[model samples]
Every structure is written in C-alpha cells, then in structure tokens.
Target: MTDLAPLPLSVLDIMPVDVESTPSGVLRATLEQARYVEELGFTRYWIAEHHNSPNIASSSPTVTAAAVGGATTRLRVGTGGVMLPNHAPFVVAEQFGTLSALYPGRVDLGVGRTPPHDPGVARALRVDALALDFEQQFAELLGFLRADFPAGHPLQKVAANPPLTGKPSLWVLGSSENGARMAAHRGLPFAHAHHFSPQNSVAALRTYHREFRPSEYLSSPYSIIAAGVTVADTDEEARFRNVPAALALLKSLTGPPEPFPTPEQAAAHPWTAEEAAWRDQFLAPQVAGGPDRVRAQLADLLERTGAEELMVVSMVTDPAARRRSITGLRELFGSAPLPQGLAL
Candidate 1:
C-alpha cells in the first residue's frame, strides 16, 4: 500500500472588509480567532494587504504580522503578501529585517509585485514615474534582502545588521507568468493566487518548475496555492451563506463599497448575466463546498498542482462561522476534529 502523505496547511487570515456594523470589530475578531487556530495546530497565520476596500482592512502586512505574531506562540506569522512595487527595496529590507529581528525565527517575508490597491492608491505609493518591470525589480530586491551581495558595490550594500542569522524564509507571491519566472530564477518558494487569478495558475506554475534554478535557499521548486473557501453545515447552507459574501465582494469590485447585505438580501438581489458568467469562471474555481466537498476538492487541487502547502482564505459573514470553516477544514484533512463537535 502507498503511504498516506500528510499535507501541511496554513491559514490566510483576511482582515475582512465588511465590518460596517462593527467598525474595527472584524480586526479585533480576527486577532482573537488567530489565537484560537494556533491552539488547533495550524502551520502558519498569514495576513494579506488590501487597500481602498471596505471588505479588507489590512493594508500593511508587516505591522499586522507583528500584531498576529505577538498573540501566538508556535504559529508562524507572515504576509500573504506585501506589495513590493509600492515600496522601495531598501525600505522593504529594513522593515522585514526589523520584523525578523523582533520575532527571531518566527517571521516570513512573502513579497508580491502587483499593485494590490486601486490605481490612485498605487500612484500615491510609487516613488518613481517609470512603470516597473516587477520581474527585474523583484530579482534586485532579493539581493538586497540577503547578505549575498558583494561589498564595495553601489546601492550601499547594507549588510543586514545582526547579519540575518536566521535568514527569514522568503516566498515569491504571484498570479502571472512574469511572477513565475522571477521565483524560479531566484529559487524561492512560489505562491499562486488561485483565489483571484485562477485562469493563470496551471500555466504559471508549470513555467516556474521548468525554469527553476538551484539557489542557497532552495534546491528545487516549492509552491503554495491560495484559494477562497466558504463552508457551512450542509452544502445547501454553505451555498446559501456564501452568496452574500460573494455578492459583497463582486459589488465592491464593480461599484462603491457598501455595507454587507443579509443572506436574504443577497439571494433576492439580481446580477447581470455577464457578471454571473464571470463569477462562475473566475470565482468558482477558487471556492469549494462544505467538509466532504472541500476535502475532496482540495486534495484533487493539490494532486494537480503538486503544491507543497494550501493557504486558505475563508470569506464568511460571522467570525465564529469563519473560524468554524477553518476548524472544519482541519478535521477534513484528518489532522484533528473540530472543537465542540462543530458541523461546518
């Protein structure tokens, strides 16, 4: 008989944008929830950076990671990731360098090149007028973060004071071909954004593995796939609950952000035929069903991608339900049972 493999998983704690009824309440709830999951044996807790959206409050991953790291003992805290094009290479090195120092052996640096927020916001963050070729910039940024750079060189070769002794693990996050190439060349871990860019995942990951070069950090290509999931007691209930959350997200992307609607309200609402098709093709692939469904789907996804890890992004209304979905997932993986006989 073939030995059963144990899959490692990490939670991508979304600083949810729909905290209208309780402003800053979601943030507080998320913090509390991360602690609970840590006790449940999760491998890591990574927060994402989203700007100009009412649905996601976390815009600075370094700061948020610090808050999360402070609350948990063994669970790793990191970015899902930090938008590198918006910040200077030196600044990023210094910030993450400080984080590595403070946390010491518990910090991770997952960097991405996309402009996470709106274009107007991107303009506000950029220091230069030239549009960045993220692949090249990402390559250079890698050099800055490590001590591998030669001395007496221009760019001041800031030898990472305290010398980056732990060598904070680095992962390159991406949703496209350019991103795949960069990660492969650097031999860093690659994270695919299946949650948003589902269409590009298969092609991008294949490109990464084919071109990967051996580097000091990794001898072979390693990858993590990030996806959006919603779970509940029954497949019907999961579908019922997931609609509003999905609708809220679609509205925010197409229109101005507004308060989250009740499940009934979302069900009653109408969507254009075109939008419906888009959602099915773009969003459905990333989302899976309840316990049995998610397990089978996730396992199949892993088999197809050969991903080393699965980073889950749960988008549900109530904080407890969101936590339950995560808990349900753990049980589905056969790692542990959900606390309190939770059904979802």
Candidate 2:
C-alpha cells in the first residue's frame, strides 16, 4: 500500500444568481466571489452553462470564463464545463483558443456530453443534435484545438493574434459509466459529478481506472471527484445553509425554477418524500459540517476513489456563506496555495 499525503482539492461554482434582486446583481455577486474563492487557495474556478434560467447566472461559460480569468490571479479558470452539442467545433476552438492565448497555461476546457438545456436551446445552436455523437464530436473538437487536423479542414482554423500552440489539458466530466469509459479510453482526466450523481460515484471511478489507456498526454490515469460541499463553524449552521440550496434544486427539477429563498422560507417548507429522497441521494456523498466532519469525509472519499485531485462545489444560496464554505474547506484540507498575480 502506498503511504502518500492526500491529493490537492479545487472548486467549481455555478456562478449562482442572487435571490434578492436582478440578474445583474447576481452577476456582480458571482464575479466578486470568484475573486474571493481564489484568495482562499483553491486551484481552478469553473462556471457551468445553463440557459433560460434566472437561478443560474452563468449561461455563457466563455464570457464568464474571461471575466473570471481577468479577476483572479493564479486561479486556473475555465468552464466546469462547456456543453459541446450546443456549439460547433470551430467556435469552441476559437473562444477557448483566445482564452488560452490571453491566459496561457491556466485554462481548462472540460467538455460535457449533455445538450445545453433542453429541446429548445438545442435547436438554437443550429446543429442537428441527434445526428452527432458527443464522444466523436469531442474527439474532433480536441483535434482542432491541438491543430492536428488538415490546414483547410471544413472547420475553419482559429486565427487568434497569437494562436494557442497546443491543447490545454482536457477533462471529461460525467456522472455515469459511459463518461468514465470515454475519459479512460482517451487517457484524459476524469471528473465524476458525485454532487448530482451520487449513486454511481464509486462504480464510475472504478470503471475509469480499470479501463484507462495511456496516451501522449497522460502516462497514467488521473481522476477528480467533485462533490457538493458546505462547511460552517458548526454542524447546525452547515445543515441550515444546505437546506436552501437543496430546496432550490428540488424545486427546479420537480416544480419550476424559482429564485433562491430566504433562510426563513427554506426552513418553513418541510421536506416532502420525493424532496427528502432527492436530498439524501444527492447529498449522500457530500462533505459537510464543521472542520472535523468535513476533513474526515473528504479524506475518506479521496481514499476511496484514489483520485489524484478533488473538485468541490458549494451550492449554498448566500454569497458570504458560500465564501465561508469554500474558505472553511481549504482550512480543513490545509492545501491553499499562495495566490500569485496573473501570468498572461
């Protein structure tokens, strides 16, 4: 058995919308917190892409990524991921290529297989969603970014003032066996979304490592397990904050997406059977509570997955509380790297 110190941890926040007011208010809050997350010593800060959702402030990861990269020094910024089907290979290459040129070596472009939102937005991207396979599309897209394709390939080559020479390290984000296999087969790093797909977490990790194939980019497999995390000064406080986010998610999936509720509103709505089950299933693997509890749980999950890295997401509704949750995580893990100024 290897006796090594634990792997490092990072974070991915969805750039959540504020419950208090306008979308711009939420955008401002998200940008401010992105900088704060960097100060706490996490590695990369990622934003997810969502459409037609007021609750999620980040609908355009490329734009949000630039804002995040501009605001933070030393924090690797990129999409937690950008959904591939919603965009063309060339456009993705151009957007992220420009980002890489602007902030070389500190950008990550994780690709997800899901359609951006639903049937409608999928139509809007102007692609035949059903005709293309995501895994195949991802491969082609990465090839373009690496400049491995023919000079006059149908997809136009990105002509940035200073082009990105090589591909940024790619991560395959998944919540199932197929995703694990895809990442492993390509020898790219895998990030399992235990926060939302808790039931398959262990199984997915196992499949990833077992099927891993070595390639030029990776000599061995690398995995990052992301989980919903909320930490506080006390267990009670942590649990209290956890409710609003969980309720927010449940409301969206079952009912309609609504603005985040005040702590009072969240506390008032007693959990229904389905909501309870949803919370338990989703939060089953989450690392929560005070420092001791969080540390122990995180350590255990890392040990179980044998992952090279850990990616955490704090789904709290309050900005200050969310900041605290991230700060507390770094303190618990004791792995905050110093924040250096931006390189590119």
Candidate 3:
C-alpha cells in the first residue's frame, strides 16, 4: 500500500464556452492550457466530447486532440472520452490510429459508453446512436485497432489504415459500476467520473478491482479517478470562481439553457432558498478553495478511493482561474510521472 500522496495528474478539459469566450477562443485557450500543463508536468491532457452543447465547444474530441497534440510535445493527448454510442467503433479506431501515427507513443484513447446527455443531440448525430450496444461497440473497436477481425467477418481485410505505430492506450470512462465492470473484464484501465458522480466512485472502483481478470492489457486493476476541482490562490477567490458555473447549471435545469455566466453575473444573480440547496447538491463533488484547501480535500478523497491516478476537470468559466488551479496543484503535487506499460 502507498502512503496518502500526490498521484499521476492528468487534465480533462470539457471545453466549456464561457460568456466572453467564442468557439475559436475556447479552442485556442484549450491548446494554450495544454501546453502550460505539460510544462507543469501533468501526465496527460484529455478532451471531452459533448455534442451540440451551447456551453461546450469540444464537440469533436479527436479534432481538438489533434490541435492539442500539435501544440504540445510531451504529455499524452486524447479524448477524456469519445462516446462509443455516437459513432461506429471502426471509425473511432481509424481516427485514433491516425492520431497515434501523428503523435506516436503519446496518445491515450479513453472510451465512454454513453451518448450525448441531450436526446436530441444524440439522434441528430445518428439514428439510434444513443441506444447502440456498448459491449459490442467496445469489442469491435478493439478488433479494428488490431485488424483482428475473426474469420468470416465482413471486415476481415479492412484495417484502420495509415498504420498505427502503436495502439493508443485505452481507458474506460465510467460514472458507475457498469463501465468499471466492462473495463475489468477486458483488463483495461478504468477512469471513474467522480467529478460528476462522486457517490458512485468508490463502489465502481471496488467492483473493478474485485472482478478484474488478467488479459493482454493488464494483469491487475489500474484506475484514474476524475474530480471537478476549482483552485485559486485564495480560498475566497476559488469560491468566487465556482459560483458562475454552478449558477449557470442550476438555471439550465429549466426550459431554455443559459449560457455560462460571468463572475459578475453570478455574483449579482438572486439566490433562492431552493436554488441554493440545488446548487449545493450540484457542487458537492467538487473541490473548491485555495491550493492548500483543495489539496487537503483531494488527499482525503485519494485516501478513500486508492485511485492510481488523478484527473481534474474544472467546469467554471474563468480560464485564468483554471490556469491558476493547475499552477497551484503544481506547487502542491510537484510532478506526476506516468507508469510504464500504461499505454500500448
């Protein structure tokens, strides 16, 4: 057993579109942030996929990954996840194959089983894209990665062309036990979405380790737990930064979705007794405060989960705060070095 300590840290950029940030600006900011984090010794930088979200600019994780990969040289770059339900596994394999070709040895393909949270966005991506079989999709994706289609299979001869120098290391992204079990059965690393579903993080990771079976990918369980963290130089500043996204999300539960609120707007918005409760519940999983406070909270979380790595996604609209969050962690954690044989 290891002592409670800093783990390998990775970045999960959800590509949030803040009020003052345009799509182009978001993309540019993402690239710039990726470069800075790599310099600070983050292990990997991942882009999350969210389709048709008025507040999320990362609709195409791979394209954005290419941009991030092109911008930074050392840290791993790939999707925090590409939702398998929305696209054919074959296409995903080819896309990552090309990505691996371009960046070789420095790509991590984190796959998710779910589709867009919005039903309309799912259908618009493709008919029945939301209801596809995740297990089958995962199997086919692996097959395509290695061109290992079984005899008599229609795609026996087709491969993810351009040729892969190496298959991107695969990690299963889950918010529940379902994803953890799937990853365990295949011996792949599992990443629990503790940021979005902290309630399920412990149980899901326990399931992964308990049921894990040896496979080519792993002989034991390995996991990354993602947290929604907002850290600033001062505790007050961090709380101030957290309000914008929380308020915007709370308002979004009703009919029309609201654009991300600025810090000023968040401060001025009237808070109702009921709305305050909802916001508190929503932010329950997040670590928000100064570097020391954030680190203490994260350390407590790590002690409970025993996660092999830590991945952070700050959903707030303040890009400067996000940058400072990374810098603060750099001071607290120093550096995170990736494990050997983590990515194939």
Candidate 4:
C-alpha cells in the first residue's frame, strides 16, 4: 500500500430532498449536517446551486452559506459553485462581500460556467443562453469583487456594497480542460468535480498545475478534488445504503428528475439493462464500503490526483446513517483508528 499524508477534508452538500421530506426540512438538515461536520473537524462545508431539480433543495447557495456561516463557529461555508450564467456579476459580489463582512475569513466564492436549468427554465430565468460569455462574466465578477475596473469603464465608480477588510476567497470550479485552463489563466484556486466527472479530473488537474501563474489571490496553484463517498460498519451495509442515491442519479440522467427514493423503493423499482449498466458505471468512482475500504479508496484518489484537499459528498436518505457515514470517514482518516469490534 502507498503511504499517503493526511489531506484536508471538506463536505459538499446538495441539500437532497428525500421522499416525503419538505424543502424546509431538507434545508434544516443541511444546516444540521454543517454543524455536525464542524464538530467532526471537517474543514469546509459547501452547498451547491441546482434549479428545477426536485431532488435537490439548494437553489441559492449564497443564502445557505449565510445560514451555515451564522450557525457554525469554525467551519468555512461556501458554494461548491454558483453557476455564473444564472446571476449578475455585481449581485454575486455584493452577496459574497456581505458574507465576508459577517463571517470574516470563512467565506469562499466558487463559480462555474454551466447553467443550472434547461433551455426553457433558463429562458424563464431571463438568461440569454446564446449571448452568455463565461469568460467575460468571470472577469466582470472578479472586477466587481476586487473593485479593479479600468478608467472610463461604465461600472468603475459603482462599488459592490458592504465592502469588508478582506475579500472572500475565490475558487473556480471545473470538470473539464477548458475550465481548468480558465482558472489557470486567472490564477485562481481550482476545484474539480470528481464525483460527477471522474474521467476528466486527472487531466484537468494536470492542466491547472501546468498552466498556473501567480496572482494576488494565490501565489501558487492550489486544487481540490470533490468525490462522492459513503461508509458504514460493513462493506455490505454501505453498498446497500448507496442504492437509493445511485437510483436517484440514474433517474436524473435518464428523464425528468424525481425526489430521492428510499432504499426499499429503489430496490423494488425495475431496472432496464441500460439503466443497470449506467448505474454500475457511475458507482465505479464513488467510495462506498466499510471504514478500511473508504480510507483506501480516498488515499488512492489523493495519490492519483495530488489534490490539496478532498471534498466528500454523501447524499444518503437516512439522516442517522448519513451522520454515521461522515463520522466513520472522520475516524478512518483522523489520528484515531477504527474501534476494535468494527475493525476491518
């Protein structure tokens, strides 16, 4: 086995809406998860932005970040990414700037270029899909955050309000070579969506490191690889618990998304050949097993990608099981070893 140094661990919460659970309940659960992870010594807790997805309750990560930031003392609260095409650059700066003023040194602004909605929904949101230029929008967002517009620029005098002593840390979230190059060009931190785009993770990380240039935000290249994980007392139990989330992911890809199904419901549902194949392929990169298995998988991932940080996302339907999974991961990676009875 390859000996790997312990890496910083973080959480990425999608605020999954389980069957029969209200949106408010899901949001509250997210807050509780943040607090729980903080106690377990996780470094950061990030929420994602997903519009029109019934299974995902987090549509506004900025609002969730504020709530989580206020609820916890030491945990860094941020957006896994706010899809930049959905909102105005100035609005994002002001919102995150206010968060910085309130939370001081604990806010991160992660931005991505993808639109969170379909064409019709995006039209409803009043975003011009064809005219959207991610590079321009990204540059504008940084300009607003830094208050560094050039002379005679129309918004040069318009300042993003609630300016604070220090700005929120900026990160460019990506899962592709183009996105990696963009982050490198801007000299910002990069986070790869390894959970969703495992195929591109290593290539993207390599591009980021190879093309990186020093800037005010960062003097050197820094990268995080975010992955899906679930750990239980035994490998069998962990695999059983992962079924519902795996089913949910398949549903999202195949058709109109549905709320997260219970494990029983997932097991009962009929699976077509194509769906089964897809599910297996998707599960290939995810970490799901006993403590020793999860620890080994994560260590391998860190070695392969050389990620400065590891962000784990576990979207199990059962709250208790979810908490236990996180706790198990903490124990596996932390200085402490697994309890005697639970040893692999």
CA lDDT scores, all candidates in order: 0.72, 0.76, 0.83, 0.83
lDDT of 1 by residue, 1-344 (tens): 22124566677876665534453787778788889878877777888887766666677788888888888886778888888777777777777777777777777788887763566776777534366777666656666776566666576556545345544588888999778898898777888998888788878888988899988778888887888876567777767666766678677776887666766877787878976775556446755666667766776677777777778886665787777787777666665432221000
lDDT of 2 by residue, 41-129 (tens): 66787788788777777788888889888888777888878888888766787788888888888888888888755677677777676
lDDT of 3 by residue, 136-222 (tens): 888888888877799999888888875566434888999999999988988889999998899998899999989898887687798
- C-alpha lDDT (0 to 100) for residue 237 of candidate 3: 85
Q: What is candidate 1's CA lDDT for residue 218?
A: 83
Query: How does model 4 score by TM-score?
Result: 0.93
Candidate 4: tens digits of C-alpha lDDT, residues 1-344: 33335557789998788797978988888889889988877788888988888888888899999999999998888898889999999999999889988888888888999984588778877899888999999889888988989999998998998874554488899989888998898788898999899999889999999999987767788888889999899988887787888899787876988999988888888998988887788778888898778878888787788788878887786778889998887776657432211000
What value of lDDT does candidate 1 attain over all alpha carbons? 0.72
The local lDDT score (0 to 100) that residue 37 gets in candidate 3 is 86
Pick out the ten consecutive residues of candidate 3 with the lowest summed lDDT.
Answer: 334-343
**TM-score for candidate 2:** 0.89
Candidate that would win on lDDT: 4
What value does the lDDT take at residue 118 in candidate 3?
Answer: 77
Residue 142 displacement (Å), model 2: 1.7
Query: Which candidate, 1 or 2, would have the higher TM-score against the true structure?
Result: 2
